[model samples]
Target: MAHLIFSEDEQRELREAARAEFPGNPALAYVLENLAAEGIDLDRGRDWEDLRVEAGLPERNAEAPEVA
Candidate 1:
């Protein structure tokens, strides 16, 4: 089992980024659920947008579409 944590700043950034990138809340929640089930715990916090990417979900850049 593993653990996940994030600083306040990281949490804020990921939260905002997810809101901007994901089309809706369900999408974001889905990613979070999967991560949690995978032993990824948001102790202090977590980088949800990054986790979304790890979960093979779409992600957006800060100023543009994601670059592969």
Candidate 2:
């Protein structure tokens, strides 16, 4: 599976779109379901980096320059 990384602006836009399309905890339901399917329990207290690594997703490098 190819993972597409999004910049902050793109992420914000996508989130706003989701909210407009589906009201009331729209993304939360999907996120929780997928995480459960992946055997990721939020109660385990996993950090953001841990979640990304577990999900086989890429993490943005803070020191790296953004591609234009």
lDDT (0 to 1) per candidate: 0.62, 0.60
* All models, RMSD in angstroms: 11.0, 13.4
How many steric overlaps does candidate 2 have?
A: 0
Residue 11's lDDT in candidate 2: 59
Model 1: clashing residue pairs? Answer: none
Model 1 per-residue lDDT tens digits across residues 1-68: 34775666666666666656765676885575454344355464658787887899756658766557
Please, what are the lDDT tens digits per residue for candidate 2 over residues 1-68? Answer: 23345555665665566556657886675664443334434455658788879999777889867766
Off by over 4 Å in 1: 29-39, 42-68
The per-residue C-alpha lDDT of model 2 at residue 3 equals: 36
lDDT of 2 at 38: 48
Best by TM-score: 1
Model 2 lowest lDDT segment of ten = 32-41
Residue 61 in model 2: lDDT: 84
